[model samples]
Target: MKSIVFTFSFVVLFTQLAMAQQSNEEQNLIKLSLDKWQWMADKDVEKLSQLFDEKSKFVHMSGTWKKGEELDIIKTGRIWYKKVTVKDTAVELFGNTAIVWNRITLDAVVREQVAVNEFTVTEVYQKNGQDWKLLALTFSSVRDTHQIKH
Candidate 1:
């Protein structure tokens, strides 16, 4: 009876430790996704490129789906973000892949037009070695519909 109890206790302790380690991994992945948003706000295309995979795909809010990587978008003058505010951010992890969804309001100059657009953005990330890299992204524009009672 004593040996059986000892074995059960060890199994429970090991399982809890494994769970804690997995939680930390998920949190770190979410942080990496958030950092990409910061880089976009700063217009740091170089840093942003590092976060993206070589074959990453980016679907812009304009309904254009770009292939290749962030460099292609940066070269075309198609994306110029000024101020970006992330809201209601949520992250979910599945094995080595993670997805981050958030509401983003941006003061951007796209195609020479200064616009304030609210969008729901989803960023897909994959863990590579010790770092997380963005594998794809899709964003859709949302109309801010708020009623003010007079």
Candidate 2:
């Protein structure tokens, strides 16, 4: 009887989750986050520069820097984001702001050495007019077994 009850509860919970739909804005934020990851890996600093606000900030394992310094690092190959494999992503919206959390495995080249690490990347974006600009991007190192609660 206990096993049967557990099975029923699991089915109901899964059904409810599947039926839930994310709003358009939430979906757009998710898409933008994914695109940003791709742009970083490709070293498309032009698009990134446009997306990042003038006062934007970036936090990495090595250190933290402002928008200009971050762009210069990417342009000069100081730290090449060779590949990023996103395991999962979550986004929250407030008025005109959105925060995204991405669980990823990063494979990068830094100072001629390649390293792979797991990180939970948090991105904060502000909506202005018809576009959204990134205000902050922070990387938090995490264990491979770590998971973000939804």
Candidate 3:
């Protein structure tokens, strides 16, 4: 009876430790996603390029693009991200893949026209050996007529 009880306790402790580790990983991924947003706003192409996979895909309201094309657009001021305010974020991990959903408010300039928009953005990251590389990013515009009280 004592052995059985000890085994159960050990299993419970192990499960808790595993859960804590997984939570930490998820939190780290969330921080990485936020950093990517900031990098975009700042037009930090070097950092962005490092984060994005060579074959990464990007889907925006305007159109879909490959990594190089998107980077070029940012580099040339075609789509300048002025600010990004993340309202909410959720991250899920599946094996080596991490998926993140961010509800964000963006202030940007597209073709020299100022644009303020809300978007539900989905980002997917794949683990490459020990590193996480962004595999895909998709943005859907949110049309909200209500203003925030705060």
TM-score of 1: 0.73
Ten-residue region with minimum lDDT total, candidate 2:
15-24
Question: For all the candidates, what are their Cα RMSDs to the real structure?
Answer: 5.8, 6.4, 4.0
Candidate with the larger lDDT of 1 and 2: 2
lDDT of 2 at 55: 98
Per-residue CA lDDT of model 2 for 96-125, tens digit only, reads 999999999999999999999999999999
Q: Each model's C-alpha lDDT?
A: 0.74, 0.91, 0.88
lDDT of 3: 0.88
Q: What's the distance in Å from true for residue 131, model 1? A: 1.3
Ranking by TM-score: 3, 2, 1
TM-scores, all models, native as reference: 0.73, 0.85, 0.86
In candidate 1, which residue pairs clash? Answer: none
Model 3 Cα RMSD, 1 decimal:
4.0
lDDT of candidate 3 over 1-150, digit per residue (tens): 999999999999999999999999998898899898788888899999999999999999889999999899888889998898888788889999999888888899998999999888889999988888999999888765423221
lDDT of 1 at 130: 80
